[model samples]
Target: MSGSRNPRTAVVTGASTGIGEEYARKLAERGYALVLVARRAEAIERLAAELSERHGIDARTLPADLTDDADLAQVEERLSADGTGDDAPIDLLINNAGRGEGGTFTKMDPDTIDAMLSLNVRAVLRLARAVLPAQIARREAGEHGAPLGVINVASVAGELTVNPHGSVYGGSKKFVTLWSESVALEVAKHGVHVTVVLPGYVRTDMTRDVQDKGLPDFAWIPKERIVRDSLRAWAGGRTKVVPGAQYKAADNLLRVIPRSVFKSVARRFG
Candidate 1:
């Protein structure tokens, strides 16, 4: 997708901060016109101005809370819109808007659970669905321009066998991981790419509480690295990317560890 001939545009949810902000900067650096989406209108507008000034790219702001049906539908409509005249086709989508609550499922509030499901599951699925059909059609018609792709931001928490404190968050991300890989397989032949990114303890507002908990330095990954690695993976036509070597090793260990062992550990620590 990088360095391709077509005028590339990307719609990035949660683009006001953290991983999503990093993605917007990196993509702008790569010459992609951006539609930055987030709930905070002021923040995204500020970012759009900064990115536009710095990169000289067309950076537009779309302030929408993805959990709201009306707002989410607006974003979906933008993704599904045709590229006519100045409105270029969105060649990339970054599904990065999500929320997580740390608690057992039974103890979590009903509204919180619904919000998590709506943003992490429903929003991701719908946004991807919105962007794919046009991409597939362009490919089938033999327009070999810039590649069309979607990058989903999941978490290492999803890969854990037992996450008592974040069961709902982990489960939501697990859905993202599974669904992204499945869609990657389904869309590959049509020249569309889907890549899921799993990160551990990134330095973001979302992880500020965990950062305050004093985890080892090695456990944390920079948001820039996550965006960089994810885009590289997507450009290379890879299905999944786990950023940070420590997390990569941990992901490998988790896959091999016994579920019974994790269950015992969860019982002791949960």
Candidate 2:
């Protein structure tokens, strides 16, 4: 549907809630048969059923903890498979599962930080690796349209700009942003698009506490805006997307300032 020569299939990670769920919903609407991956089976299954019924598309769920090697492998295997006749090969991969390990670097628990890195960085990279071969093949075969894509959900905290609360989590996201853009360049010739979405705070289950922790309302971009902009950017084959206008300005500001200047601002603000 979405400019693809044929109907597409998508695998959306972290599909149980938040931006991932919205991606699943919107993709189904765009005529993608979906495979929703999340640790919580019931939530994702319910969502899949709802989407299938509403959109008249097949939606399946794969419940897996991406941090577990075996569980993660299952997702990789699924992405590797191009289903039998009339079945759509995966045309989109949304790497959205992530955890926020909040607090001062010294105060953060080692295990929590490890879990965050495993999901936010390692899983994202691995999943993108798993999907690209088939995506590239399909593009070369002339079976898909411009930019069969991957969307890695990075965060604005990863940019060079000052983020008062950003710490270990920021480092992990910076890896995502850079990795996605580099990969995008290598694959663009093959017509495989990759976008690293650098969204600021959004209203999601993950960010509920951040809202209560005195993060101002102005800093929040609603989930709808994030989905809309992310899809738009992905379609345009953008290397990265900063969903909100404020975050766009922040991204622009970060580009011009020296690291030393931003560091001074963070230290002063914190």
Candidate 3:
């Protein structure tokens, strides 16, 4: 909902690369002024400059690690800003920053597990909380001409039986999926939308190792498609989006198959 507002503003987290970067680019294409958040200062600054120059839109970079308490507080403050000053009210917030640790729950370093949870679960929840009040108020007061929303990037793994080696990561995403659905229901009456994107294997640096494992081409979804489909679904007021055709079929199969049968199959193949 790019509206009569002169320049709609969107805040995109993990904007340094991959799907986050794609969201920034696509939103810029739609003429949204962007606030790009990522830990890599240089990377996000470079991306901001490029997008600003190319699209003739304002693009600012906020460099912070979402897992750090101080850094997370800074972002929350930005999102909670009243927008009477230099900062503009955020029209959209994309919770795209997350991390995953390899190995089973017992084998992962306790600190690593904590960091992953801080990023994937705590940060996502806190940021959404920070942004929602303003959006709800705007809609209630009738000042929001365009859409006010949040799009949380989750994974298809969230809906499937847990991965023995990635239980925490999958669990975190399940929280996002379920939490987003609940929040979407709560905010719909207030004209605020929440969409959770559940993507399968996607072509990104995080999935480079899997890509090298020679999975079939259909198993990998392009990053662009995920962002595109996600934004489309959000604009249309849809709460959940599973972006790939093959993944859609797989998601359906996962739902119908009994857990005992899946566990048995995993014991043999996993």
Q: Is candidate 2 or candidate 3 better by TM-score?
A: 3
Candidate 1 local Cα displacement, residue 166, angstroms: 1.1
What TM-scores do the predictions have? 0.95, 0.92, 0.95
lDDT, residue 147, model 2: 54
Task: Name the lDDT value of residue 87 in candidate 2.
Answer: 48
lDDT score, residue 260, model 3? Answer: 98
Task: State the displacement of the C-alpha of residue 242, model 3, in Å, after optimal TM-score superposition.
Answer: 0.4
Which segments of model 2 are wrong by more than 4 Å? 1-6, 84-87, 160-162, 266-270
- What is candidate 1's lDDT per residue for 109-220, written digit by digit as tens? 9999999999999999999999899788767766675668899999999998677338889999999999999999999999899999999888888877887888888878
| Native-to-model Cα distance after best TM-score fit, residue 204 in candidate 2, in Å | 1.4
**Which portions of model 1 miss their true places by more than 4 Å?**
1-5
Native-to-model Cα distance after best TM-score fit, residue 44 in candidate 1, in Å:
0.5
Best to worst by lDDT, what's the order? 3, 1, 2
Alpha-carbon RMSD to native, per candidate: 2.1, 2.5, 2.0
Which model is ahead, 2 or 3, in terms of lDDT?
A: 3
List pairs with backbone clashes in candidate 2. none
